[model samples]
Target: MVIAAFENEKNLPLNELMIPLDEDGIERSVPALNEKWKDSRIFTRYTSFPFRANTTLVEEGAALEQWFSETGWFVKDMEWLLGLEHYRFWSTLVYNRGAIESVVSFTQSAVPYYLAGAARSSPSVFPLYSAAHRATLQVICRMITQRESDRCWIGKEFLGELLYKHYLVSIPLLFDLLPVYGRDNKQVLTLMVQTIFKLQPKYGQDLKVGLKFLQSTFKTIQQQIVTDRLDGNIASLTRLNDLAIYTLDCSTVLALLVECYPDCRSICTELAMEQSITNFYDNTIVVLYKNIHAMDNESTYLTYLNTARMELLSAFRGIVNFQLETVLDNPQRSLIPADKFLCTLTECLSDPVFVKDYQRHYPVEQDLDVLRQACRSVDTFKMDFVQNAYCLEDGANGLSNGYVEPLPEDDESFGEAAGGVAEDELAEAGPSTASGPVLTPEQQIEANVQKVLDVLPHLGDGYVRKILSRYDDVEQAIAAVLEGNLPPDLANADPTEPYIPADKLDTLFVETGIERLNIYDGDEFDVLVHDQIKGVMKKGKGMPGQPKNLKEMLDDKSHVREMKGRYQEYTNVCDEYDDEYDDSFDAMADSESKTVRLTAAMRNALVDELEDDDEDDAEVEEDVGQSGGKKTLDFCENPEVVRQRYEESRRSKFQARQGGFVPPGGGSGKDVVGKAKGQGQDKSVLLNRKQKGEHKSSRANHNRKQGATFKRNKGMIPS
Candidate 1:
């Protein structure tokens, strides 16, 4: 207190009297505690003197702006074990050089060292290299998604910083060649991809960037292969094998996309809009065919050739199935004369290796038989063409069907991520004979029951049936039963029936809609596509909310809205033109009266309030004079606070703090105004200061970051 009193620089914006001056005091003079000075933990604690990076400079400078993001009140003790409050923690990240950019620079620099031939061969270097690599990925993920919880994934507004500012978090950064992101760490790779997915709709100009990259990647292979492996020079074909690793990453991205948007038309709409995706499917299939016959059966470049082959085939099949199943408007949808699906396979027929592998792992014969059965009733296509497609029946053009070497058995799901009913579910529903009768919903319930049993066979049939009856979906019911998590349903009723449909009529009173009943053959096609689905997917624009961390919650932008309100008071001023150049008084200087005047209503209200308590003689005094030159308070923008003051003012003994009373029988003591305005130094300051900043909080508007004391934070923290 004595030191503060002696300080003559009290009026300065960033005066250091007692507490640490800005961040300069962070440079502790104590030799014994030098280590503590470097530690960021020192600042998070409450301190009398604290500061923040100047937001104006950050917003204006193009170079510095890219390295750092706009800091908010999110940094705190909980996120980092150190007990630093938001202001201290945020300043720590931005004050010294830059943390985010530094990490990026380090990662970029170390990539070459790790990729060097010596580092690659050295057993000792691998662990260090691997740890460093994973750490870099973790840092990238952390920076992009600051909030660790699920509820608020990557903040929507912060996404702007990621796209326009930080160049590290990009699609090419992860999905490019081995030199860029060498080791195939599935978890780390998935995290990077998820970051892109979350950033999408906004993140890199997003989905399109990733899509274009994948499109080019697939196109590259198709371009390299000149119709056949032999046509391309042997060297070029061998070079195609180099892309084996790259395609594996690309295939993962496509598989995730398929899983995210289960509907083929839906994803196609996102990638190419209403345009036919036949070419898109062909690009992938062409890449697969290239990989199948590329000079070598296996390459050191691609460790998981089998996995890649299966993925490529799976992604291609999904795309083809979508084009075939959807009631597309394109003329190519009519496969009556020529099957484009078989054409993609025709090139493969020449290669016996692919034929045997395809037959063994994922048989073409079975898939074709299923297609024939599905198209049996629909009149959309000529079943004869599909039936006559001999690509499945024959040795497939010169290739021999006799298996020379058997491929490994399929362990993973043998279908697209979002494929038809499971085997267990179908079995319980009972086999469908050629002349079998239609099954009731109860029979469908039986199918779901068996599906649950296949996974959790320990549970009794009755329990699975009850669960299936409660929740119509197989996955949902099984999940609920395993986790024992249930949400309250208002229309709860225990049904005696084994199965229940979600949209079906529970009682006769509820009328069944035609769409729901679907008396017409449910071909799962023919629905009108409102628009050619185009453009990258955006949030709340038909993009599915993917399952994220269990703890994730929706981001609350209320604070953002609140801060936005405060800045609106001076948005135009930042643009230029002298904001203080008010000319309202230019013409009124001579005509305007010097004396402040009140309206008739104000004078009348004042007189009435100043009247003596004698009810019989309630006549207000005439010529109610203005008291002690007290000015009327400016309007407060806060509706809630104004309402509160208005309520308090109407109290019988209402007494204001700022308004001085007029002499006897004049205006009432103190003002009865709904709200008081002032600079708001403190609660006591309210008695004297008028015209309070309506947007400022009670305690030093944002720690004076925007107050009269605002200054640059660079010099404050010691270098």
Candidate 2:
């Protein structure tokens, strides 16, 4: 009962903490054993670790070596070491500081033994030597830990001199032993690190140095992964796992530094320490997670990489959660950079392949919830950020790979728009083909353009293609062109050609022309109707009436009077126009431009102040209200200078585009009408005849008079 009560006491108040002090304020010597209980006393289980009145540091180290080197010796050292929590009963441990040096030597010696046990890579307890190493670690940690009894603790001024100056603790040694044992056992390591700050808060700088080295190591591994350095190697998994361990080890400890040491959080925030773990999460974990399927035969090693990813994020959350108000010197600013953390999650979570397993093990939503709760607690959250962050609508919504479900009608639309449906969706959607082998959309579009161009021979091929691309239906585009309703850009094209061919001018009015010319085919209107009201009769050609000549067709203006009311609505609007002023835009314009309204007294004061101020001595900028930004006079450039600058900028951008850009091949078929097959025919006719000829039987029209019309003499002006 006495031993249990004695061992369980901890976290005592500073006033309650004490050690025996003599009248001279010096510790009194220990009295010898009582006479009656001397021989029948409690057996000393750790006699091998004997310490006496005159043991030197060298002698103690040798004793610890002897005790550890021999197997099956004193196993009670760990127990006795753990019992030294009573500072008053064990004043000699602090006063006689050689035991610290001795334990450190033993801990160092036990490294080889611990490594031997760890080599099995099994989930068993460490070997005896490794256990001893941890025991020594506890002893050292207790020594450095700040005592509740302020009278007995080491002064911060002498802490660096005694520990660091003597080379007892360093970044290399701490990290070496730390990563080795810390993989399974972090409590001991955590204790030691915490004690380090308790002893001297300034050691946070040393911790930062170690963290920097780890972050650099993490970056190197990330770069190597990005470059696929281990792609084909047999030992790739092993090498990668080792690298992950090395970097993740230090990354985790960074959080420990911020957590265990209070001042270091602010110090590290000044150094932007959050980016270390944040970058590791982004560049390493997220990258590897994305490419996990590629790790085929070596997935086990990559599993640890995923776990390391979660660990890194946990550290990130911890940093953000523990951020000091003065970390940014602005209390309202969020510690979590939403762009890096919150929005990135939204992007990564959209892929069910990643989210399926990730959500299963580490519920990303829970972490986000924790962040939300933390923000509310700290009063530093962005509502827009929290509201926009990704979340599972139904727990099972995105688990399976399927046709993409549309983004939920939720609040997140205000922020990062959810990623689009899969990029290959169009490729998967069967093309415009009639269900044989499917053609690509591009091929279908090209075929459609040629079909439109074929029937509209007067239209430029370029114009037809433009029309086809805009309307995406050959029939509709052809119909629109036939109705003389081309879109604005295609309006410049000559849809109607001249009736006379320039090259055939000599035959325009020859003596045999009117008598035997067969240029006029049949009248487009009914021949009976043409005979009743229009041009010459067609009885000369063994028909009821002759086709109207270009001259007679132009002179027929009967249809114009039939469409007389087309513009009446527009004319009425013009006739009703009145010069009325609009005040609707006044309020909107006032809001957009700065409008300062001053009270009468304020205006008088402003006038007085301006009058008192010298023009030469006036300030260049003034504190602006409402806009919340400074109003400064930026010198205006001369128009010529502005023009030169704009030109230079424009030229540079143009050069860049020209250097790297490849324009889409021109699809327009302009100016192919009256030229040779390649040079004279309009793109419409050339494309229509040539391109369409590939599919249909041009054998029937092979003997037709193709270019004779274009080569023949054209009519005089229609009128």
Candidate 3:
């Protein structure tokens, strides 16, 4: 029969004949068990028409047919299989590499395609439908693979296309097929829902169609509840988490739809207000809470609820919040008309009930005395742990290595000890001051550090071991002496000194414990500063320095939190601006000249910023002569100089602004049109540098044309 089907076809390849041809005269490469049958009268007669009214699918089918004719779909072909598999493989790699949200959507879309062959109508309809499903999957996989998270504008454009063409019609149609394959195919069905949701999040109206399908699902469940009650088939009649998921999905769909189509709120409001449905949702929440508290006994029954708890909570929370805002406070003016419903939802969220549920997980501490004791214990533990592992004498590294030095001891105590060292050391060394070319202060510090290292071995094994074990002591010592001058005799001492006077060192250490704080590690600080510079280069604020003044901290939280927040906000703003700029770029990419000009300008600006600290302040003044004249008057005041510079630049740009003029490629409508026109014409037709010489020679002729145009325009004036 396969041979017979192929024999009737004009295309010579039997493989090509097995695949259905789309209406566009191209071979459909997708696998089909009944290619001949789908084209025949039996299947199309019933399922064709109003059910398949989407023009986009029709056009896509034509395009698919043409593509398939070029490359046949061979299931056994390794290359072909790999090509299809590439989408998922790349998406997984990207997901693992920290591309979070988009990968979730991409992976979800593949689920339905995997189930297509299984979800068919008998043997007759399975082949053609499966083939079409596979084709759709291929396109989906390709689209997902190509989509980068950074391409937000491209996503918007694609979404507009999908909405306009109604490419979204396939989603709900595909979702409807899930149940037909049976409950055993639950994984596939779940995946399908997740994928559809992810891909179509922007298309809130399209999602409404899927939500409508789910609403019907609810009706079916309600019917089953009544039927089971009457027929003694009832197990537990309460709504499960799966029902909640469907409800949440519907709500999410409806929420977005409400933004696009506010009327959906009215329908949902009416349905939710109905006493029976409200009772059902309330009962569902109770069941959900019960399952959360006691899922061990009823594992199978609560499985769906347990798996979808987070989603259910989100939906309920949103619904409750929405109801509270729209209906609770302003009952008379409420558009939803479900005051009681809103009240119930609010009570469910607010009460001792919700609080109790959370408290089960995170119990609140009420006794202040006990809390104080507990906090002290925790602080003691932290101090002990850090001290043991990271004492200044132990030479511990910084936080990245899981160590923090103990706070410095008193400087007054250390000062007394240093005095003893100075006297004792001077008596032994015989006033070691230099007469010829004295050692520098830095040289003296290096000499002292070297002397410490040399004596470290001989300073008793325990002492040597403690100092060697911890780098924190060195950090503390450096911080302590950074401000104070060392003795001239010690500074004049040789770089390599013996281990004789360990007693004097204890004096120096005691005197130097003046609340030592490490400001920045030379290399580590640069890394932080570099990141801040990058933020500034991206036109975002640099991270704030530590808060010494109350005024700065009063801007927000504490010094630490405020600085961290500024860093985060800077990164976030850059991210947002990048998205906007990329969108602007993509919008202009098709217009070649504008993209080139805009890209060059952006690059030039970035380069200038990198090279010049005050590039932003370097806008040249229009009246340099006028500004130069003012320089005789006191220009020494920093504020006055800055203000004058700003004023000068404003004056310079003013004439251009007043003439209704804009710089070339300055993001204006006229500029875009001009650039687009310029890009469209061939470069050879445009005047080049070589042609410009001849054009300049003909300036008189050009002037004559301009003069004639001006004369003609002058004649057109009414005066």
Candidate 4:
């Protein structure tokens, strides 16, 4: 039926779309799709709706929106809607679920274009009509609850994408819708709270910022409540009543109030009259418990609630028990059995029925031990005694009535005195013990006040400050307000109103020795940072002006010294680089001596190697000639003699090149005179031979003289 309705609205063929069915739909026009959808059992386990199908559906809506606008069907509706308040659609959608989604999707989709149009306007005007917008909100809300049974999740991006584009202008407008639509729409309230809870899992601090914004809107809602009541607007009142009921979702609104602002109780109390405020809190708790019960199958939600409940109970117990403890401490004061209240709860908590039910419903074990211990303590207190205490029937003494033993009557008053009193009877009837002392109300109050002082710091800074300031002027204000000791004008004065006039504060600044805090024109106060630092300083121990320990002082000195050393090292590196630049300048001026010597040495080595190669080639030529002319001579007859002749020939040829004079074999310059001078002394050749020939020729001559003593040298002419 739903699929058919959707198809009929879109004018689409039913054959293309697969529709899931229950056993009931038999005579439907596209029965095969329904049959297939059902037989497939796909509905039971959908992670996300198929994207192709979703896109097709969205395209159908786009076509529908376009067709309606072009054909002037909704043009009239649009014109009409444009003129009504933003909430007009919200109201309309509350009655009709089919139209709810279309309107929400349309508004969310159209917001950007509207904003764009607004921006282009001479003086920007929002395109949204408030009434129609609100009506659309109601429609969306109706859809959320109606569709919840199907578990048809609306992806968060559907809202996020719209908000992302138009947040600057539309966020405040979105906030306005909450006040208008949230009051009666429980489903919408739950959806929003759940969404916030999802976000809070990751970005709690950001969620707090969002919560603060939402909380401020509650103020406007309070004003609207008053306005509607005074104007006798029944429609508005009914809407507001619906909104208020919906606002009870896990007391999310109340939780936000407490979280965003500390004085939320007083604000909410004032908004809800004195009598109804308590009912509001009770209703909120009912909503919380209902949600808790709803998640019985899952342990997570139960655990969260159980943990939270335990924390609250523990804190309350701590406050009450401490009061009892203090009352008992005073010798004059009697203890008020405040512990009885929790004792009963503790006993109930330990009962298998309560524990099993609590565990089944809400299964968080955050501080179960503490909760169990509390229960155990209460269990030790007799149930009957607890009931009597709750009834306030138990007096200072354990006796039923507040009674004391009558003093013993004197024997002289009686005409006949007792002959004998039995010793055993006297002993048995002697003053039996009475119960412990009971505290007076005044002492109880004092003990409670002391407990409150101890609990103050835990409540947060804003709460502490507000509480401290509330009764600062009690002496003057109380007598005037309560006792009628002062004028009626003073009696009705607002406590929050400043005691000193603003003008007087300025005058007093000059009159007293105290100087008003001077803030420079350019300076901005960092109150948050200042508060953080003040908190740190406040927690510090010892005399305020006292010096640190010797170790701390020495460590501080070391730290300073370490930093100075690092800085000096950095400066030294910088100075070294500067010195390097100066050295480079001096190096440029005295560069020629080393460059000239190095060039000459390189040239000489190249020339000498070339000359040595030539001498070796010449010797090879001479040996070849001698070998050709050999007449069956044995070259190895005297090996050392041949070696000495070879050495002499090499020395004689090498000496004639290079500019230096060389001896042939035995005398100075003898080798040059005998075999090398003039015949090979070309100046260019001498330059080429200098490095290779000089050392080889001198060493060769020294060897040839030694060879002559061993054998007659054939290659060397006597020199």
Candidate 5:
């Protein structure tokens, strides 16, 4: 049936092809397979049968390859088979093994092709691909689990080859398969962890994929730890720390991966906080410090440093508590080199470079206090431990007598002690003592005063002087500071000049000639100045009537309208005079005779007089017009007599002008208008006179009694 299936490869069902097995269900010998099968034509035809068609065929094939291993036929022919671009065939080979060496060798040799096929496989055929993936993972896991103790190293070597060569392809496969493998499968989990550790030292693009795979594996471990409540897994912790240290070594890769994947940071943080793992805490601190140092973002650096600091504190507390417990439990073993640990921790916490960098970025007080406390605790512990250790060492050395022979003066120890004392003195003296003579008390005081003088510019000179005078001694200074006493100058300062009271603020504005303070009473001024004043004034203590000021009185819309109206009236009067003056001046300048010319000042005087006369005439006309014909008998005898007198006076003036006789008032028409011919009295004056005469005539006519008669008189005429 197998031969027939191969003969009709295109026609027969691929599943029907299977290797012939004996009654025991083991693969039968394949003696018939020989040199002829090694040829390309026969090999390709034989290997074309699908390996997944039957499990027996895969096992039988491996047996056949083993049967011909001496002739090197399988090795020569399997190369062509592996090159056939068959995922199922390779998966089958992975599923069924002949020799460990042959299987591992074949798998390693075919990893690149498998990865390429997996990469090229379509999503539609993902089920088939997943089956192949499962088979591959099971094969690797089996090889690792089934290996002998002496040959277990081969498993790691094989995994390294697979991972380092095919990291990109393996990453997705591992991620997809990790959850499927589950934490229940300890062997597989161990193999996965071992595979990650092997890939740690690798560099290049593959290292990043390896890191992602490791991160995913850590997440799996984390979940398992949570699910199983495995608080302390030393092996897992060690592996995690190893991975972190490896990542730290490749800082650029770690930074890129952590930045791209925030979970990487969480994974690292978890690994660092794993107290079960040896040196995990310290490793985490170093890694976090390195990451913070490398990071440029202030916020990210602060976040990392804070986490590290918390972990450091926890670690310190644990170490101290553990040491104390150890001492309580076994005094002899209590000497746990805690002083060294404390010293190392102290050095790390007090790293001047880190302190400078940290302060440069986030100079918060609480964070600073945290570091100081850590250092102080370490210092106190170290001091106590040193004293205890010294007494213990002396007691152990049988020096409890308290009387010992001193080393000879010229002995190396004595000389070294002397030198150390000298160095200590020099260190305590400081750089200034080394560079210059020490200052006396007076000189030190003078220096302090000079420093105060330097700062006096910022604090006003008067204020600083007053403070100095009040706090003459340390006790007074302390009392003054405690009481929050102000300087004498400020304490005695007048309040009125500093801030204008609300009610009187408007007076200030008025004095400044500002008629409209309300125009400035908007949010713009409030933002620029008012808000600041309010802040300084404090709540409930504002300048009496602040904010409202004179806005209510000055900003009244009705008052604004009245002022506008008055301004408009004044402008109209001025414009009217301007026009009249301009016209009069032009007329005078155009006259031919120099006698009629008027200087600018004279012209202005004439314009003013004319304006006054026009106003008076208008007033008089208004009164007479409103009164109508009603008049007191004493004020006016009769309207007809009054009209006759006005007509006689006008006739006499006209006759006088014709005869070249100046009026008794010494006024002439020529002086008012011009002496030139064709020019009569000023048109404006003439118009005014005409209007008045017409008004009078109309009034007289309206009041006339038709039957009444009157006699002409010197001052009156009858009508």
Candidate 6:
């Protein structure tokens, strides 16, 4: 009947199918369907609806393919059948047994279809407009409840995919279904958490969707934890681990959102704080603290600080109770009372360094009270321990001397009287007992102040004494020392010397590696400065001011001498270069010498090449120019040969000119040589005079020529 109804309604439009069934149709169909299919063998025996048909029915396995093909629920263009009045009515009929199973099987099989359809469907229409969506939710709830069993309606992987699909389609429906399915069931919650974990990396890139899901899921788990339904066994452990993994995965996304969208950080921090507080154990709290502290934002820091202070306070209370019980129950063990231990703990908590971070976020007044109360209680208990110990010792000594008497068991008054006598004797003894004298609170405070003074050079003895006299509280004394507020001593032991701030003295005496001659005597400012200057002077000479022995000083002097020798060697190298330059000039000035004098051009070229290549060629060239002068002068000495070459060059130039050119001086080679010799001028003087006349002629005819040919053709003339 169900199959026939589905087949008949397969062609109906989704909108028409969505109309509610009338009372008559429900009355006529409800009973028939309930009687035929409610407890029928087909429904009772099979996990999924039997979609395949044959004249002789053969039992088919509950595969999802059978539902789509035979039922036509998910086939193309036939999905509207799920919205038919008869189909929804049929879903109502099987609401108890196979409804959830069939829905889960079908949704798991047709996840891609629903995901695609959800994209086009309106939010109001998805997961509820169709009987298939109702069935999908039923199936999800059943799967969550039945998650622990080996025989599941759908596999975990497929179930996870279906859940993610539903989340994409309608987040409202998914959230609604999560509590119904995962609320009380650890296995279901674990699966939900783990599925979210898997999908977060893939689809959770959407901050809104991802953060909402994470926060919702975390709240769900937290609710479970608060109601005490989550077992503390291994199964719950697995569930928590899954939750932790999901939180960690989402933390990175939340952090980015916190930075880019700072307003959202408060929401994220609150969510994290709630989750951490719900799972508030040692390891989880530690992880939360680390993550919160690592965030550079102010909100997270303040949240973490407040949370840590509360957690620490709670833990300390528990410790106090436990230790108190132990001390009360076992008085013979000589254990300190809880208050003493709490005093030590409070000392750590009240430290300015430790409390400096959280003071802005958490109130310190209560903590200061806790510290003071614990200390006062411990002081009272210390007197008790002392009195008890003294009484025990006296009794032991009396027994050893055979002078003690045991009180009768019925005489409670005798025990009270003996305790009173012990207390009185302790009071009369004035804190001095056989063991030792117990220091008063003031003395203890003074000792702690002295310890701070010993380490800090900025804390002078006069300042420390003044602080001690003003503030009886150890914390206040320490604070005064740190703040540098102690009154100055009016009477300087050395009246002749000027007053110096302790910080300046510290820098001058301590940091400068200056050691005092006698620390017992007060620090002498003049002596400290003199010693520091002497140490610096000695260091410059490589003589250690605080050498270990005489031999060390001698070795230092030798080292200094060796360093001076190396310095002298470095200076000699610079002098050698200067001397080379002077020697070159001296060689040039000698008239009879054959050394070559390099012009400024040659010298600059040599220097540039030396700088460019850093080669020995420049040095070799210098040596040859300076020392091998005879060879250079030998090359320059042959004037007749030079004159002959010049005449030949002049004749060649006359031939090459387009207009025939005459040789200058208009004479044979001997006439030129005789004229050059008759002038009694050196080669340099003759060359200069000839160059000057050529320059004049070139300048005079420059405009007539196509270009300045004389200047272009001028080669290296003799200097």
Better of 1 and 5 by lDDT: 1
Task: Put down candidate 4 lDDT per residue, 238-311, tens digits, no spaces.
Answer: 34333433343223333432332332233332232212222322223223433333333232333333333332
Write model 5 residue lDDT over 1-719, tens digit each, in one string: 12211232333222222223243455453322122123223221111111221111222355434433422443443443344322233233333333223323333322121123332333433343343334445545543332333312223454455444533224443333333332224365545544454444453344355655554543443354344334553334334333433332222223323333333333443333223221322333333333333332232333323433433333333433333343445544434433433343344332332322222333323322333344433345455433332222111211111112211132233435545435455557787543334569755444433334332212333344345556665445435534767666656753122222245446645655544445444334444335553433335634655555467647656768779977887665443346788888889887845667899999999999999899889877786789885433466488997888886777577667654434444433433333466666666556656665677556456445421333233335643
Off by over 4 Å in 6: 1-155, 165-191, 195-443, 446-522, 526-648, 652-719
- Per-prediction tally of clashes: 16, 17, 10, 40, 0, 0
Model 4 residue runs over 4 Å out of place are: 1-134, 145-179, 191-477, 481-719
Work out the TM-score per prediction.
0.32, 0.37, 0.23, 0.22, 0.19, 0.23
Residue 348 miss distance in model 1 (angstroms): 11
Off by over 4 Å in 5: 1-343, 346-719
- Model 5 compared with the native: what TM-score? 0.19
lDDT of each: 0.43, 0.48, 0.38, 0.37, 0.39, 0.40
Candidate 3 wrongly placed segments (more than 4 Å): 1-204, 234-278, 282-298, 308-310, 322-719
Worst 10 residues of 2 by lDDT: 32-41
Query: Which is the winner by lDDT between candidate 2 and candidate 6?
Result: 2
Root-mean-square deviation (CA) per prediction: 39.0, 39.3, 39.1, 28.5, 31.2, 26.3
lDDT of 5: 0.39
**lDDT per residue as tens, model 3, 409-506:** 43234435545344444445554421112358655444445434332212232332233234345554333334334345433544234335455335
lDDT of 5 at 679: 64
User: Evaluated with lDDT, which candidate comes out highest?
Assistant: 2
272-362, model 2: which lDDT tens digit per residue?
5555555556556655533542444234434445545555555555554444233234425545543334544444543543443345445
lDDT rank, highest first? 2, 1, 6, 5, 3, 4
lDDT of 2 at 341: 46
- Scored by Cα lDDT, where does model 2 land? 0.48
lDDT of 6: 0.40
Q: Report the Cα lDDT for residue 342, model 2.
A: 50
Candidates 1 and 3 compared: the better one by TM-score is 1
